[model samples]
Target chain A: MNEPILQVNDLHYYYNDNQAALNGISVSIYPGERIAVIGSNGAGKSTFFLNINGVLSPEHGEIFYHGTKITKKSLPELRKNIGIVFQDADNQIIASSVKAEISFGPMNLKLPREEVSRRVNMAMEYMNITEYGDRPPHYLSGGEKKRVAIADIIAMEPDVIIFDEPTAALDPLNAVMLEEVLEKLSAEQKTLLISTHDVDFAYRWAERVLVFCDGQIIADGTPLSVFQNDEVVKKASLTRPVMLDVYEELVRNGLLADAGVYPRDMREFRELIGK
Target chain B: MSHEHTARSHTGRHHHHKGGHRHDTGGSSIDFYACHSRIRHWNPGFRVGFSIILLLFCILANHPAVSCVIILTAAWITVGMGGLSFRRYFSVLTIPITFILLGSAAVAVDFSRQPIGDFHLYLFWGYLYLTYESLLNTLFLILKVFGAVSAMFIMTLSTPSHELFSVLRKARCPSLIVELMHMIYRYIFILMEVQRNMRISAESRLGFGDFKTSCYSFGQIASNLFIIALKKANAYYDAMEARCYDGTFAFLEEEHQANPKHLIAAGIYLTALMSFWLAIR
Candidate 1:
């Protein structure tokens, strides 16, 4: 579409024992696109994110950012534009206080003091954690720590933000808050790639979906297209999103017209049902 | 969400979690107190400086009066100004006091085949003797240690580790040490939580049904924790790398205004302690 912000070509990664974590993986991630990556455990989702974020080097093939090859010399520059929100907020938080943790990414960029402070304040305010600026991370609840972790990445103002199961340990209220944050980020036109097992969330939130299976991209397309592929669904052992199942059942019963498009969320489902 | 440390009851949070470890068994309580300490808002640099100076005075002066005054002053500052309960202060000190008692025993009590000191007791193997001079020296050493440690406690109890790290940064402490401290401080609680959960799970499974089983379970837990720590270390580095880390460290420091009254009070207290030491000497 718009000169893919990130392009991975036949990427391969191996662990210490020579086991392939990623094998022949290739994808082009467009700027400002909301992409959800779904896979079973040990499916190389985290490794893929690490590779794209330039934390892990691919043993084969190459990755490019804005058409430039990602080399050892370009990693620092690439990292400045692509941030990863790790699954464990505790491990991701490197600073003692919430403000310090948020400022860490910006400070690593070697920005001016004023700009760093300004970004820290803005990120805190955006995450609604401005009051926790002086509080240490150990005392914050799991949800609050998650917010601070997101703020840590947001402060860097990265173009592509990768979240590794951002909602894993989060309670229901926190999940809602996280969704709102994703919506805000999407509105800001930031490219967001989230790896999660929550098929319903992926179905509802993502404009495009990537199903990672055994370190390879088994399916990649709009959520509807990818989810409708029965072979891919069965191969990946993915459960159909509740909304998708209900929508298809209604169409089968002739209670609703086969509108030729699936609803992404509750609002769209309601609109489709004309109720 | 209140997220207010002061509003949260401390009694319910710490005791159940800590395992039987000698290294600050009161770790969480200390953290809670430091985070909520009323005087924490004071400039950490000033607090650190004051504590160091007070500690030096107590050790170098070596006068019983000076040590006593320091112990009193530290207790007063910790309990009175910092809003820590008197019972909590003593409870934290209990471990150190017990350690001191055990340590000074060798000096305070001596055994000889023949009775030597004015105070001697007959034992089947030998004679247990206590010399007044040695007993007095041991007493003075105990008091000096308590005074010095109390001075340190005043600083640590009032300032959180992050604030202390910020002060260290200002003091030009090596970035590597400070950065390591920052990471270690952040992970200690996480690791502790993980270990605590594992222990509870093991207990539920009767992994520690007997002494032998307890030893086996402890070994298993230790090995698992080691593996987890290694994995966590790699993940932490990856997370840091994603943030554009290039071996450079920068931490945001909250600016704290120094209260001149606190400085003046410290000066007056030090001056008063010096005079008391001189008079006693």
Candidate 2:
């Protein structure tokens, strides 16, 4: 197997209140992987992301990017390659104008002015926010702000992008748009890790699933294998995706012949049902 | 809305003192108008410099006639050239005008046990008096204040905060100060929305039914907002760190070419104001 792009081992982080945000987490994130992290609120998904990105140093354990262990001296380099799209777009956006906000990351990289401007324009185009380039981001709708927030990091051209609840405040249409963007990002071979409560979206979008519960990884595998484990799902307080429930019920009641592998999404389900 | 516009939050801790230019505390209305202003494409540096110079001219030429011209011309430039409606122009002026009236009252009205000036009124407690010279002085002060403020309004109501910050950047202002202004400007709206939502929820629960309850709710909201602001600041730092921020900020300024016509118009206006000031004196 190709080397993992990011590796976290025995990571433990504690909040100021002495609450264990991440007890002990060890994970290998390969390049070009679409991973969904699903858990209840306060399951330490955000803390885990922050730790890996070096925003919050873990009390124990180490993180490695491209086989080089992250340390104080290497933090800047690590952060340059790992971008976290925070859940609150308002908190993430630090610039007044959308164009300037997008330029922030690239500028911080000390890139040439022409390179920064090119990345800013490209990121704005990628997020379909070229028209809002000059508009104040505060006036934008929640979803539009989310796109600009994503563009802020996209301009940095990070190798790995972690979105913490990207669809929380997005409308249905905007949520679909986010998914399309995720598809495009994944196609470009950028590693993507999304933490979401939407089990259906995770089932459809992520090839690999990581179940986080109380700061520990309860399960990690393909979405089909992870969701099929009743023990882990029940422990993590996760619900089965609606489509999977229907498929399982049909097979249990002998309405359809059991297939060795369940379909991953609607298109596959339709093919199985001969629609 | 008025309260939110004027209410200072913890984020205002940054010392953002621009020379003679009062930081806009009038909420999003001015910003919205400025963002959509027809003349928003004009160079912000020229706008800032022109307004500051005009403001100084108004102050030094403290004559009422000169002030009147400043007020009328500024109103014309803001409303006519900037495309802001006359109604909005006056609506935004209302806050400063209120301050002017209250301030002028101190200088215009006085109490005495007996009449001692050109204008006097007998009252049960005392005789109110207004000397002719004092009245004229009060009038001069009011007009001077109004003219200075209106000149500032032309700049603020026509240029968005981003442009103003960029102008500051170009004027050799420290990047740290400009970056702080950028962060503060962006978060002000967020904090205001949070405050507005909390107030609405408080009102729905009869939190403002009485003076006592209103005070209590206000305290609760203020404290909660402080806590939220601190949390937000920490999260914002995390976000900035993720972007590889290394104690330096490089803001992207929109390129706007300086138009000589604007300079010529400014020159003609200032020259006319100076001649008017000389003649009126």
Which predicted model would earn the best lDDT?
Answer: 1
Tens digit of lDDT per residue, candidate 1, span B1-281? 32232124354444543433443357777887798888988999999999999999998998887888889989999999999888778888986999998999887999999989979999999999999999999999999999999999999899888999989988999988998898888888778777877887999999999999999999999999999999999888888888988787787677788999989988888898888888889
lDDT of 2 at A227: 89
Off by over 4 Å in 2: A16-19, B1-25, B110-114, B123-126, B279-281
What is the TM-score of candidate 1? Answer: 0.92
* Candidate 1 Cα outliers beyond 4 Å, as residue runs: A16-19, A271-274, B1-24, B112-118, B131-137
Worst 10 residues of 2 chain A by lDDT: A134-143
lDDT by residue for model 2 (B1-281), tens: 22223333212312332222243445666787788788888889999899999899999887898889889989999999999877768878998999999999888988899888888989988898999898889999999999999999889998889889999988999888988898889888888778877997999999999999999999999999999999999988999999998888776667888899988988987888788778879
**Candidates, DockQ:** 0.54, 0.55
Candidate 1 C-alpha RMSD relative to the actual structure: 3.2
lDDT of each: 0.88, 0.88
